[model samples]
Target: MSEGTGAVTNAGEGEEVLQPFSVTIGATVPTGFEHTAAEEVKEKIGAEASISKDRGRIYFEITTDNLPKVHHLKSVDNLFVVVKCYDNYQFKDTKEDALLDLQEIAPVLPWSNALEVWKLNNSVKKKRSRRRGAAPKPKPSGDDSEGEKLQAETSMSEETEEQGEVCPEQDMSLQREQNSETIENKPLKFRVTCNRAGDKHSFTSNDAARDFGGAVQEFFQWKADMTKFDVEVLLNIHNNEVVIGIALTEESLHRRNITHFGPTTLRSTLAYGMLRLSKPQISDVIVDPMCGTGAIPLEGVIEWSHSFFLSGDNHDMAVSRTVNNINHIVKRRQTGGSTSPGLPIDTVQWDLCHLPMRTSSVDIITTDMPFGKRMGSKKKNWDLYPSCLREMARVCRPSTGRAVLLTQDKKCFQKALLRMSGLWRKTHTVWVNVGGLHAGVFVLLRTGAIFGSTPENKRESQKASETQVEDMMENI
Candidate 1:
């Protein structure tokens, strides 16, 4: 393979083969899990990632041969092949000047390597689609084929007219004939998507994309398509930084796991980050007390198959959704011809304050608590948080157990933690963005104190079961 270019030379044939070229890959991860995503990239891909801190992005270099490994990553939402990156881009003071500069740079920038990678990625996507049971592309009818032939001829005529503008009639005829020989080669359809940031920018993302896209169209003679495009070119601008890339993923990787949906289903990518924070061990029994749609436990079982997962929720609908999602995955595996098509996960319906398990049985507990906006209310959280935490501590093994809980009600969670200080100790906190709501993923370790011996635990157990039942009804 060539050092910078993604080309190789065949030894026996002396032919240049386009194979494994180096490219800079960029990934968008969940906000606040940037470092966590970067660490996964390093461990899995063996490449050092440069975190774009607070921006939910990371960049790393990898050969095209290693591209498949990137798709297996759990933390990234989207992937793109970096064409160019300018850390200190100096935009002109006026919008027109800035846009003009962008247009002028279109043809001069490197495109061959990135476009090749994009072509390779298309094959990868098609293979994955087939594996997922996507229908094959329908062949064109006779009439449609004839229309496409006419369109290709018209395009050839346009190109000939432009090139032979000042030439004789015979030269124009000759150019047209030459272009007609390659009418079967269709021009690629593409769209430019611009993401612009910075208060000082004089142009909107659309304005930049329009001007830059026009220049790119003129240079490459490719069609401009907004929706049905084969290529997606990205123009990202953040203050003084600018990056140009080709998208590698059509849909976000977060949608890879779950098939069944719930009202408040968590993103599988964020669930992976939460699991990473807990650091599950071999043979560990992890449990999710409030597994809304079983996203966390499903992700855990898939990534850490050696560990067992138990998912439970108080609501009947939530439990059903979890079961359906797990069955969908098991069926998918069975279809894939696995001898033992069962996952190391099970779903149950149980109250958060009273789990159906032995004390000190679970090795880890991770859950997404109701944030009072969609599932429950702030008034109920006052009673719900403390009760659940106590029960989780009871089931979790002391000193060796850990819990990673995500909640938008930081104030309420912190208050409850203060009350249960004897059973759980806050070791780390990761602030995250969940659908525009800022939340915290609190990482707590089980203290050495036994469950019933703590004053907090005794007080929690002394609360009337009647009041707990009333609170649960109110939440429902």
Candidate 2:
């Protein structure tokens, strides 16, 4: 045992050993992202350390060949051992010394390092044998080997046949069928996530627990609620699942894939940011008047299981692309029997500045306002904000429906809010890292009541009927 380095050592007790020590590595700030990064670090450390999440943090266990160095390293609180294992028959004094050394670093670790030292010794013995004797084992001969190979082939063929029959189109039907059943029977939680660095994917719910396996299982078990059980954890699998975590759907990560696409609002942020809204108990009707790439509204519908996934945008190309994408997703889900959820977006060719829907008809108005940096020109953005927001406010039921919007230009948006006569009130702001742009996601509530010239014009029109009042109003 070593005091400063938190290293566990094996003195010349005739054989080498491997040690298992649990560690917690500290994270650099812009907080709430340490958990995901820590898990990634654990994997990078190779077979020695494994991380399982617990209580919103990760539980890291490392197996080391050099116990003394690890013990010495323990003095650094950034990474310290919480548990240690050793063989019982040997190294009693060494274990005690190691414990004392590790305690000086982090006193909270449970379990003695001596009880399981035998296993480490065994592993060392096996490694030594493999190194010392380089000769490979001879292959099995004749019918015995042939029989085993044939059996393996048969099993593989059956699996391939089953998989070959399955396609993306049947995926949605399968999800709908599974929705009717309870969540307890599932094998692993399916999570979807966008591959954004520094985004928070640490929340644990009952759904996360049943769906995720490996390190995620440990984390979710400790932090999540278990009463409401539904297990599905979707993660962005790009970059070798480096950005792997929970997502609402696969579409949540689609925005990042658009190259030379420039700046854009992510669907994950828009969906998760809208939890503050007050709404009816209705099962569906989530609308995005400006559903560019079908990000916001798709997030809303998939996350909440809202039935009517209605979306509209002024740009024909964007609308067409969105339609094709959504249609592809829908068609795949219909034929593939997938358990994954679908947003089932219905795209319409319309302008956000003049919405086609009736007043007070929407349950949610979640959108990403186009800005000069992304798709629209600066002058166009200036013209678009107020008119579009006014229309969004007009169609939404005040006090009941809420709008979640993301914008890089907060000052201009605020001016629009004020000019529209309080159609929207700023509620909350989530600073998100969408690609490289650090932007604010705003949640606003519609005031519902008519504002600006609409109410004033009505009052003037009524005033014209009264003799004395009309004369005074007209003159003024």
Candidate 3:
């Protein structure tokens, strides 16, 4: 295939060259949202993604012209360009034999295209970094400064020790020869990161990385630098499957949105997944009653600019943090030459159980509730969930309105939903991983039953009167 329009040119040839080819791109997403991420890839990049269930990964093929679009995907946490994939790789019986096989395969894989893509991605990332006002680090000079010399020495020592079977004398001699030969022409620095999952594996991830890395160094004559590497190679092995790739993202993209963080900040990637589940439409009034830093509403306003978002929390700190995060985005937009630097979002401080919004006003409600671990207690949630859910039903438009609520207190939430069955109907549920805690995202639709006419409303009114009578008797 001929390279597309944005194909990389050979550095020696000072002209643009068209070489058409397709490469597989791998992305890591929130574990339970693999389908959500794959759907996003299909919608935005026009690529049909293959989802690896329960692994939080998806793969799709795209031409070089679409590389920049891959970086802009909101559902992916990290991106990598695949060099090669083996669906059913055979492992040798012994650890040494398996690791040796990995080392032997490094030189024969298709590295040219992936490396070219990596080079092209550097320009894209640099442009983004500059826009974010992040200054780039100066390239290390070839001159043997004391720090460089020490780092090189330390790296050699560590590699030798990690291999355990390497002859220190031979390694030092080889290093000296390699250093002398590349003194004039500096080689790219690199590191190998291996992630292996499977109980049947004979080798640890470190063993595979070290042996494979040594072979890569020998084949390319590249220097091994762990911290300041120019390139990162990934070795992902799961069961009989193996995928070798070049890392395209230096850091996880989930940090792209938030500036000011609260005690329990939800990941932006996960937030996007939750928002996608809501299926937002034009002019939808979305509300997050317990917005804690306003992550949900902020993500909603950015992705679905047609929707208006209202974020509120009872805590003073949370309200302040939400406002700060919104202002940061406004400033960024203003700097980017936006004629109107305002987002369709607003923040307030209010109790979740006593929202100030009028009944039947909101179209959608999405919020990440306190998991009772970091933010609130389990005892409090027992009381909090049912009360807030009632209030949510009051504001949500009947039949057409929906809410996506995430919480680790599933038992409490389920019980609360049972009490509000007259007002809310659970339509779907997605189990997700949040900060190592197992949580559920419940998708509930508002029942056609009017606000105060529900059986739940009558029960709440009776309970409130009973409590008021008890207080009055104590005063008398």
Q: Say which candidate scores most in lDDT.
A: 1
What TM-score would candidate 2 get against the native?
0.44
Clashes (N, CA, C under 3 Å) per candidate: 1, 48, 4
Query: Superposing all C-alpha atoms, what RMSD in Å does each candidate have to the true structure?
Result: 11.3, 20.9, 10.0
Error in Å for residue 85 of model 1: 0.0
- Per-residue accuracy of model 2 over 16-116 as CA lDDT, tens digit each: 33234433221111112233334344444432332322111232334433322221221011122222222121211343442233223222323233212
Clashing pairs in 3: 2-19, 2-20, 3-19, 3-20
Order the candidates by TM-score, highest first: 1, 3, 2
Please estimate how well model 2 matches the true structure, expressed as its whole-model Cα lDDT: 0.41
What candidate 2 gets wrong by more than 4 Å, as runs, is: 1-281, 338-344, 451-476
- List TM-scores for all candidates, in order: 0.86, 0.44, 0.85
> How does each model score on lDDT?
0.77, 0.41, 0.77
Model 1, range 255-302, lDDT digits (tens) per residue? 566666666778878899999999999999999999977889999998
